[model samples]
Target: MANHNDRSGEIVLAEDKAVMAKAAEWLREGRGVALSTVTRTWGSSPRPPGSLMAMNDQGRFIGSVSGGCIEEELIDRYRQGELADTLPLSLGFGVDNQEAGRLGLPCGGRLQITVEHLNSVTSIDQLLNRIDHGELVARQVDLGNGEVRLLTGDGHPELSVSDQSLTKVFGSAWQLLLIGDGQLARYLARMARMLDYRVTICDPRETFTDPDPLPDVDYTRQMPDDAVRNIAARPRTAVVTLAHDPKQDDMALLEALESNAFYIGALGSTRSAAKRHDRLAKMGCSPQQLERIRGPAGVSIGSKRPPEIALSIMAEITATRNRTAGVAAT
Candidate 1:
């Protein structure tokens, strides 16, 4: 299957990769292109502040800046030759309820859209290269003249827009490391990918782990503690022990709790979780470090099966990730 997200189903948070890649493709195929970004929004909006969409002269497109209507308007304008002359065009929609209704925007919603005539081919290639290398970066555009800059560093997944330019990040935003490769771990891996998380499964015990490995996830035969350390101990990463055994779970927990991973969770019953914590305490873990472990590791969803439990754990993980990023969970 074809995928636009850089190396689709392999990595996470290449949200703009699809749009950017499609724009590059159409350009290679000799088509006029216009790129748009939702710079600002107020009130109820379908897409968020940093949403992106790219369209070509043939009215073909990828990604979206709104639920649907905004793309239609931009495509219609492009087809009519009304967009090319005013290259770095700024337009507004849904200024009022009446306008919102006519444009199919949510009531009281307003979107500040900046559309640019595409020209920076080399910049797009370089941006994609950086993303492939896993460096957090942003592509900023000068709305006045279409100059694009690829900045290096801890780029946020959100966008910041001023009247003169728009800045947006593209790269891995979150990662999930599972300490086991059991059936539940498989379920969690798939579900986590659906949420755009780079997923990895680590289990040294081949006989103990699931025999069938998922193709998209990175499967490692490393010991649990080493696996925890192997991943970047950053705030955007999550470590969860789904092995349900002290041998595997505790090793991961010891390393994960000491690291700065945004979410650290363990799968088990309350009694089992308490025992795991005590076992770690005897192994020199401080109370505060032990306190950080989410035992019984999930929302209280009364989950009793593999998929349901995975869902609950992901819910807790998602909430933690959002909070760590200073974003409200919707």
Candidate 2:
């Protein structure tokens, strides 16, 4: 496939989400490419560690590890074909403390980039194929000599890895679990679809109804608790209970807290939430697990309507997905 600029580089996250898929597609079409990832960062970094950027042999690139500070430089080097035989290289931009002041970004931040060559055996196509199957894979980068390696980590075996400068490889996919079939849940479900999350909604009441224009979401008419009983939760998964019924919300909350899901929240008022907490406590929930639930869900966006509240909820979920501290719901 010839290099094409899909304008995806303009988006900080679009590139991150699709780079692996795009790289895999290119390699499958007989094109060569390389990937670079920022595995670690310190103090006020532009992108967190694990941020990735990929480039085709023709110098077409997607994704960014910095806020446009280093892509142009990397592109120039890539187009000139300087990295083809460098034996996998880890390059650091921004000079040392004194020189950093001369180059800007002197705010005392560093960017470490690892460049790796792509080939048939190293086909990101295969890697992404595994990811599509829901497995977790890790890419390990040997910093001393730039030897890119791939290994299957514990848990999901269907995950894929593409970056070459990885010192450690871990696999995770964000999950968006909605515990209601109400209009608000439908709205949130649509937004979550755009965010590339696997969405599941559980509603026991047929009267609660199905959303007319639902996105590609998994729907279960089973009782919320029973619907979620078999699914194993992980840190990447988020469970939001919006079903107002205690039986639905309480059961899902209890099960979610017992699992590995990182963001567990419910939709209710302070008084209602307090009551729910007391109920859960009476049901034997510990204080620590109860603390994990964000009742009266969503950040304080001053939203009074369902759509606006949906936006607030999405914002909090996005922050949680990005590992950013969420503003408490007030």
The predictions' CA RMSDs to the true structure, in order, are 5.0, 6.1
Query: What is the lDDT, from 0 to 100, of the residue 224 in candidate 1?
Result: 95
User: Candidate 1, residues 105-150: lDDT per residue as tens digits?
Assistant: 6787778788888876777788888888887777878778778888
Tell me the whole-model lDDT of each prediction, alpha carbons only. 0.78, 0.68
Query: Which regions of candidate 1 are displaced past 4 Å?
Result: 1-15, 42-44, 81-90, 95-109, 143-145, 153-157, 162-165, 278-292, 324-330
Candidate 1 global Cα RMSD: 5.0
TM-score of 1: 0.81
- Which residue pairs clash within candidate 2? 130-158, 135-157, 135-158, 135-159, 136-156, 136-159, 141-166
TM-scores of the candidates in the order shown: 0.81, 0.78
Best by lDDT: 1
**Candidate 1: residue pairs that collide:** none
Residue lDDT tens for model 2, 1-330: 122344533524433437777777667777677777764555656766666777776667777776566676776787788776656776886535654455455356776677776554453555566666775555555545655555674442222223423443334556788887778988888888777777888777756665374757878787766666655355567889997888888889888888877688899888999999999999999999899888888998776899898889888878775653211111
